[model samples]
Target: MVHVILTHEVKDFFAWKKVYEEGEPLRTKSGIKMTGVYTSVDNPNQVTLTGECASAELVYRFMSQPELKAAMQAAGVISAPDMKVLNKV
Candidate 1:
């Protein structure tokens, strides 16, 4: 499986979470198979999201989508996210 990791800071975790949850259908349709979200213990505003995707290409496409960027902005993501794509060893 392909894995996608994303880390970013948000203005409000709960608000961002609500928007993230609302994007489930879009994510699924874009080829995400499963997803997990976590917040940093040191800083609650720092969030990490991991998703299992069918392929790295799909994940790349998902991340590059304008809609996703707009949604993240609306969700209060305050900084550009760091992203990584991995393949299970």
Candidate 2:
């Protein structure tokens, strides 16, 4: 399995959470299995989402969709996301 670490800004914790919850079905449909998620204690807007996937390519494909990008932008994630792909030790 491949692991993905996504760092992005969160406009509002509750609002972003709503978006995350709303996207749960899509995540599953795209072959993502969420391992965990984190938000900065000092700055709630900074979020890190960790998940396992069959392929990094697949994850990128799903997240790069126009609708997904638009939703993220609406949520106040202004900058391009930083994605870290990992492998199990």
Candidate 3:
């Protein structure tokens, strides 16, 4: 199993959440096993999303989409997200 960590900021939490929820199907079809999303304790606009996927390669496929990047930018994400890939020993 692989863990994918994504950290990003949005202009509005509720609006961003709507988009995320709407995109659930695409992710489900893409082989993400499970996912958990959390908001920063001190910053409402910031979010951390952790997903358990079949493999690091699958996770990379999801993150490497041009549409995803454009959506993030259009949603007012000010900076590039920080992505961390991890594995359990």
Return the lDDT, model 1, position 42: 97
Q: Model 1 clash pairs?
A: none
Ranking of all predicted structures according to lDDT, beginning with the best and ending with the worst: 1, 2, 3
Q: Which segments of candidate 3 are over 4 A away from where they belong?
A: none
All candidates' lDDT scores? 0.90, 0.83, 0.82
Candidate numbers sorted by TM-score from highest down: 1, 2, 3
Q: Per-residue CA lDDT of candidate 2, range 1-89, in tens? A: 89999988777777887778787777898899888879888988788899999988989898878877777866667557899989889
lDDT for model 2 comes to 0.83
Identify the candidate with maximal TM-score.
1
In candidate 1, stretches whose alpha carbon ends up further than 4 angstroms from where it belongs are none
Whichever of 1 and 2 has more TM-score, that candidate is: 1
> Which one is best on lDDT?
1
- Model 1, span 1-89: residue lDDT tens: 78888899999999999998999888889988657899999999999998798888898898889999899999999989999899899
